[model samples]
Structures are given as C-alpha cells and as structure tokens.
Target: MNLIELSPEGNFESWEISRLKELRAEEFSKELGQSMLYENDEFRLWDITLKHKERLTFRRVVNDFSYTCITDGFGVIHLGNGKIQFGQFKKGDICSFNMKENEELILDVENTGLGILKFIVTELKLK
Candidate 1:
C-alpha cells in the first residue's frame, strides 16, 4: 500500500517488512484499491521494497511459494552463484517458483521508482 514507502538507499530484508499493527485489510483496500485477500495458518504475508543496486537474500519457508505483483519499477533477479540473467520484470507481473535453503536471490533494481515486492511465506529466513 501507500503506507510503507521504503528508502531509496537501503537494501531490503524480508523479515524487516512490516505487518499491519491492527491487521486492517479494509483500510488497505480502500486506499490501495485492494487489500490482503487471503491468509491461512500455512502462509504469512510479506511486503518489502528495494532501491536500485539494493539486493535482498531470501529463502523459501513454505512449500507453495508465490510472489505477488510488482507494484513499482523493474528488476533482474540473480540466483545464488548464477549470473544476472538478461531477463527483466516490471509491474503487474506475478511468479511462482521452487527454492531451496541454499538458493539465494539478489534483486537488481533498474528503476528509481523503488521496487515493491509482496508475497506470502510461512517461515522465510535471511541467508
């Protein structure tokens, strides 16, 4: 939502993403035009942001892993020990994939809009 605008100079940590103190989906829906639709015991919500050249390392904590749409900017993601693929992603793109504990992702932001990433995970850890 428009609530947590991240800093442009700081890297991101999935654990640092903030959760609504009151868990008010209604307010988010009203402001952002959509809100958290579903959450169960198996998944926890995550919302994060990254500036250009700022990367975050994340590990899958759930079996059914999924990423929500990117709300702002574009980026290229690099897996652990892999080259930064020429591929790029922009806003409104959603993806799902399998990841291992040893795998890591480094998001290379290519825009100044700030990369907004949201997803659901149960037990993610910083690697």
Candidate 2:
C-alpha cells in the first residue's frame, strides 16, 4: 500500500497498517462495540466506545459518506494506502476523504475509553 505523510514531523507512521484485515458486513456493530445513537432520513449517527489498543475494521459500503468525531482519547484511521490522526474534533475542524465503494479501512484506538460518534449520510439520490 502507498503511504503519505502530511505532517512535517511525520507522525503518520503510527497510523500505518500492520496486521489489519477487512471486516465482513455481517460483523457490523457487533465487532466495533457500537450502537445507533440516533438516526433520521438524512443521516445516521453511531456511538462507539473502545478499550485501550482495541481496533475496528471498517469497510465503506456503496454510496456511503460519513464523518467521525472523537470525543475522548485518541485514535487513527488507516485507509490502506495511508492514514490520518483522529482526536477530539471541534466544530469546523473537520477532515474528509473520498473512496470507492467497499473500500476497507482500519480504526485503531489508543488510551482506554475511546469515545467516537459517526455521522453517516443516507440520502443519496441518483439523477
């Protein structure tokens, strides 16, 4: 896989994939310890809590678009090609990425009690 470092110090090394594997759709929340905190026609929100050193394999389904906010602790997202740091995300301090359908990703949690909120778009309309 390709790796890119956007930071001058190159802190991206910690986010690299070591032994991650793609999770099947059936695994879903069961593997991530997640629960649907809220949902609506426009989007769905999920809340997840992870223990120290825990990880969740993520795969984007077709037409999926989502945002994640880390409420507690620190984490990382591995996009197979590269990675990004994930910590407390304030309003207006967001980052995003685009990917093809069924792309597999990895979420690594550091520090116990890692809390995350995921907002997923569900209103895709084709012209």
Candidate 3:
C-alpha cells in the first residue's frame, strides 16, 4: 500500500526497541539527504537512500513539500514527541504535504524492509 501517513498515527507491532528516547529536532541536521541534488530560488531537491534498518533524522520546517518513492519498502517514523508510525511505500508513489503557517514536522525515519528505501524530496519555497 502506498500511503502518506499523518494525523492520527499508529506504531508498528514488530517494532522492538528497548527504550524510546526523545529525539530533539534542533539537535539533528535538517538536511533530508547526504547530498543535495539541486536547489534554486523556489525549490530544493534532495535524494534520499536508506539501507535496510538504516535511519535518517531530519526536521521539516518548510510548509510545502513532496516526496516521490523510488523503491518499495516499509518505513518507521519516530517523532520528536514520542509518537511512532509505520509507512508502506512503493515505486513511483508520491506524497505531498502542505501545512499551515507555524506548522512543522520533525521526525526520524528508518527503513524497516529487507530492501533499500529510496526517494526524492522536493521542498517548495512559497512566496
């Protein structure tokens, strides 16, 4: 299932973590990828690739953003507020979010599937 899980989120049943620590958004780099593909006046493009069980942390301060899935995989999101969620994505799947003023999304994502998870994130700079 291709889904952009948000609003009322849920945790994964197979998620076995000895302890869930509070992840500080400010402490982590806000960059979505290790390398930025492109950036201009109105948009920023990022390529993200995560190996199985690998995790990446980032803060979503921009209000308008979209991500296209390049590989099929399962993911787990660990929010800074102690919330957890499971995301199922497939190749060519696209998810976008447009939040209101003063809204932000901060979380860490982990690839839980057996294969790699890859995606391209595009952040729109609204004037």
Model 3 lDDT at residue 26? 59
Arrange candidates, best TM-score first.
3, 2, 1
Models, CA RMSD each: 12.5, 7.1, 3.7
Q: In candidate 1, which residue pairs get closer than 3 Å at backbone N, Cα or C atoms, i.e. clash?
A: none
Task: Tell me the spans in candidate 3 whose CA falls farther than 4 Å from its real position.
Answer: 1-25
The lowest-lDDT stretch of 10 consecutive residues in candidate 1 is: 24-33
Residue-level lDDT tens digits of model 1 in 39-123 = 5565545544555655444221324355655554555443222233332444555665565656533332222344454333222
TM-score of each: 0.41, 0.44, 0.78
Candidate closest to the true structure, highest lDDT: 3
Show where candidate 2 strays beyond 4 Å. Answer: 1-33, 61-72, 82-127
Residue 118, model 3, lDDT:
94
Q: Where is model 3 poorest over a 10-residue stretch in terms of lDDT?
A: 16-25
> Judged by TM-score relative to the true structure, which candidate is superior, 2 or 3?
3
lDDT of 3 at 41: 91
| lDDT of each residue in 25-64, candidate 3, tens digit only | 1566667665789999998898889999998865645448
User: Which run of 10 residues does model 2 get worst, by summed lDDT?
Assistant: 118-127
lDDT of 3 at 60: 48
lDDT, model 2: 0.41
Cα deviation of 92, candidate 3, in Å: 0.8
